[model samples]
Target: MSVLDRIIRTTTADLGARMVRIPAAELEARALMAPRRPSFAAALCAPGLSVIAEHKRRSPSRGAIRVDLELTEIVRDYERGGAAAVSVLTEERHFGGALDDLTEAAWVCGLPLLRKDFVVDRYQLLEARAAGASAVLLIVAALPIRRLEELHGAALDLGLDVLVEVHDAVELDVARSIGARIVGVNNRDLRDFSIDVERTYRLLDGMPAGALVVAESGIRGVDDARRLAAAGVDAVLVGEALMAAPDPRLACEELACACG
Candidate 1:
């Protein structure tokens, strides 16, 4: 199986165990009572290329990425650096991340939060809402068109913004078909975890008009951010570069300036 397949399988199994422990009904109740969240999509639409600084502990391709820093500290650094929003990788196992990370970021940062995870079920949407996330990610390569439509509709019904992620022309079409308001063009190919920054550029023309465009993955520094911003990208979601920096705040500040 490919890396995406394995992660999805593991996520399914783990989600099942968690569901048993905390019933879906309980999650729903918490979601309802959860405080209002800031507008994640709006944050990206502001004038320049917004920086969505991400908190990622590690990845399947690049493991052990700055695990020493506390989640709250990392988020605060992102905020102080002028990040438009924050993305918290909530997948465990392969990513070495936890849902608590999103909760912690939410508690510590005033910026909007995106629950970056393999969302295969609506239950995860409830989890995102209850955890104080302003938005959630939905990768087009991970789910069927019908499933994507269902989850997209479900997320909207719950008043949560969805960043529909696409890696290629086909996936971009799928995202457009689903009326994705905030579309993220991921440079990394999920099947093999290979990254090509040009992927975002290649797919830029096919993007839906007026849709908020976000470039995800493979963003190395200011140059990359500048190029993407010039190409009309609304935002860039960067993780490894910021997480690995000696001073994540300074790193984010540099990127944020370049992005704008």
Candidate 2:
């Protein structure tokens, strides 16, 4: 099986187990009781190219990235460096992250939280809200068009902004069909896990007008973000680059300052 296939299989199975423990009804109740989420989509559309600094302990391609980072410390650093929003990876097996990582960050800072996870069901949306996430990622390649639309609608119903992620033109169409307002162009191909910054450029023209676009992955530094910003990107979701930097705060500051 391809890497994407494996990841989805694991996600679906894990979601099933989680459903048994907490139940969707309980998740919904918890979400209803939680405070209203901040607007993640608006954050991207702000003045200059906004920076959505991401927190992740590891990845399938590059394992164990800055696992020692305390959620509160690094997240506070991102905010201090002028990040517009924060993305916390909550995928368990491959990313070495958990929902607790998001809750902790939310507790310390007020930045809108993106629950960066391989979300396969509506249950995950409720879980995201309960964990204090202001936004959730909806990958076009992961679900069928019908399911994608369902989840997209579900996110809005829960008052969470959806970052509908697309890798190519066809997926872009799928996102558009759902009337996605916030679109993310991911540079990494989920099938083979290859990286190419041009994916964002190649898909830009296909995006709906007035949509807030975020360039994701393969953004190494300020120059990379500048190149993308010149191409009309509204925001950049950077993870691995910041995780590996000698000084994450300085690296984020440079990107945020330059992009703006």
Best by TM-score: 1
Model 2 residue 49 CA deviation (Å) reads: 0.5
Give the runs in model 1 whose Cα sits over 4 Å from its true position: none
Can you write out model 1's per-residue Cα lDDT over 61-171, one digit (the tens) per residue? 998999789998999999999899999999999888899998888888889999999999999999999999999999998999999999999999888999999999999
In model 2, the clashing pairs are: none
Q: State TM-scores per candidate.
A: 0.99, 0.98
Q: 37-149 in candidate 2: lDDT tens per residue?
A: 57898788789899999998888998888966688888998999999999999988888888889889889878899999888899999999998999999999999899999
Task: Give per-candidate clash totals.
Answer: 0, 0
Alpha-carbon lDDT of model 2: 0.91
* Best model per lDDT: 1
Lowest lDDT sum, 10 consecutive residues, model 2, at 36-45
What is candidate 1's TM-score against the reference? 0.99
The TM-score measured for candidate 2 stands at: 0.98
